[model samples]
Target: MTADDHALALALADAAGAAIRPFFRGAWSEERKADRSFVTEADRAAEAAMRALIEAHRPADGIIGEEYGTRNEGAGRQWVLDPIDGTTSFIAGRAIFGTLIALVQDGWPVLGVIDQPIAQERWVGRIGEGTTFNGRPAATRPLKDLSDAVLGTTTPHQFAGDDVDAFMGVARAVAESKIIYGGDCYNYGLVASGHIDCVIEAGLKLHDFAALVPVVEGAGGMMSDWMGNPLDAGSDGRVIALGDPARLDDILDAMS
Candidate 1:
């Protein structure tokens, strides 16, 4: 994508942020989907706004959103969106929730944004370009050792079956005092901005993580599936994020 396309992506994220801001800290209807996860009117409205923007500017590009289903399925270039990545946190009146937007071309992520509408902070990243936090360059801190790493996850409860054991086993290797819980997509932004060292979680869909790849990686962190494979359209739901790329083998081994 060119500079103009990148700017368009960011603008779409801004629109999504605007669509969700009014619903935050305000009463709104919520419902449970077939998977028993919560969804809100804000989620739907935010996605709708994003979709509208994308359709208007890039009519041929496809879209895969959390609230709305996929469209233009065969289009090689597609946008993956999660209007409210941390709905649980959003509902609880926390500022850690975010809207995730990613552009995938030929099944590879080329651009991504994590926007916290309430806090008015946004992280933008793209292939071969470094990440930027609110338009300033963002970079992660180097990891000296696994034991000193600051770890984060939205919640361990979302881990299912062997995932719980996999995630906890990795956590045990890091300093217990440095672990943080319940920060949704905010945790990934923290990784990009040098606040967190790692984030591991399971059961994520494509939209749940596609938007995070560039932001984390462009900031000098490495994001991948638990097997230490680079993330792409086909990755399994389990994910591991490390601020330092050299720690990928250690993290994967710990989880295994």
Candidate 2:
């Protein structure tokens, strides 16, 4: 991947972010989904706007999005987008939410960009091109064990008590642990940058992962499901990612 791919990925995410900005402070009625997740007027509008932008810019490429779903899935090059990753937080007046856009070539993420409009921070990365938060390069810290790591996850509060207990077993063994609630795609950026050691989640879709995969991989980390499989569209609901592979196994083992 080169500067051009990174540029295009960033531009796409930025366009999507702009589309979601208007609904930030505006009043929007909420609606519940089958899974109990909330969706607002902004979610649908942003996703539609993002799909149009991707179709216009990457004419031949396929597109996948959270709200709009996918049009073409078998294309060699596809653009996956999540217009507002943390919709609940977005509607709750929190700025921790952002847009996730990624370019996947031949089933692998080639470029990724997470645009946090509220924080005025944009993370751009390309496979083998390294990763950057804003304009500065970012890389994870060298903590080799979960025992000394400060782990961050999307949400542990909502998990089943038994599942929470299972995870907390791993957490209690760690030096520190915290939930970056409503972090969405931002937590992956955090793990890649070394501010957080890990970002575990139980439920996710393709649009949920597209943008973060490369950013984490570019920063010399690994992104995979809890069962030690690659994160494809059909990935298990659980995900485990770490900069240090050895420590990752430790975390996974503790969970098991």
Candidate 3:
């Protein structure tokens, strides 16, 4: 993809962002998913509009979305999207939610877009082309020793006894960490662009993560699970990411 294609995606994200903003000020109807999570009308609208744009631009491209599920089954090129990652927060009028889009070629991510419309921020990354924030080059912050870094995770109440024990087990070892709830997927985008240092959390899916890997890597970060592997173990969504590979072992040790 050239600068022009990136520009087009930016425009698409901007439009989708605009569509989500009105729901921001006023209340929108919502429904509960089977998982008991809230899904607002904005999610449906944003993904629909995003899907139309991708179809018109890349007719042959595959699409996997949170609200609408998967379409255009092929192995060559694919687009992953989460129109409104934090619908619960968006419905509650929180600013942490955002839109995510990723284009994957062959088996790897080639381009990613994370547009937080409310915050007026666009984080973009194209493999080999480097990563940028609103057209400016972006990089992760200088990695600090594990003993002096900040880690962000979501709600802890969702964990059970053993889960809570395991989570706190890691927390106790961290030099300093905070469980910042309600970020939805925006935290990953923030980490990709170096706004956050590391994030370890549970409960995620491919759509929750696919758009994040390349952007974070493009910004010089590494993400994995408790086993020091990608979250492809086919179990739960326990995942971890760090801005420094040097501290990966430490993070893993704490998780263990």
Q: What TM-score would every model get versus the actual structure?
A: 0.97, 0.89, 0.89
Question: Mind giving the per-residue lDDT tens digits that candidate 2 earns over 45-77?
Answer: 777877876677677788887777787778888
Instruction: Select the stronger candidate by lDDT from 2 and 3.
Output: 2
C-alpha local distance difference test of each model? 0.91, 0.76, 0.75
| Cα deviation of 33, candidate 3, in Å | 1.4
* Runs with alpha carbons beyond 4 Å of true place in candidate 1: none
Residues 1-256, model 3: lDDT tens digits: 5676677677679768978988896978889999988888899888898888888887877888889988886647777788987777787778888898877666565677888899888778776766777778778776666656666776776566666776776677666444455586778777776767777777777677666776777788877766787543143567777777778877776666
In what order do the candidates fall by lDDT, top score first? 1, 2, 3
Better of 1 and 3 by lDDT: 1
RMSD of each: 1.0, 2.3, 2.4
Model 3 lDDT, residue 122, Cα: 78
Candidate topping lDDT: 1
Off by over 4 Å in 2: 1-3, 157-166, 176-182
TM-score of model 1 (CA atoms): 0.97
In candidate 1, what are the lDDT values of residues 144-218, reduced to their tens digit?
Answer: 888989999988788988888888887899988989998989999999999999999888898999989999999
Report the Cα lDDT for candidate 2: 0.76
The model with the greater TM-score, 1 or 3, is 1
Q: Pick the candidate with the highest TM-score.
A: 1
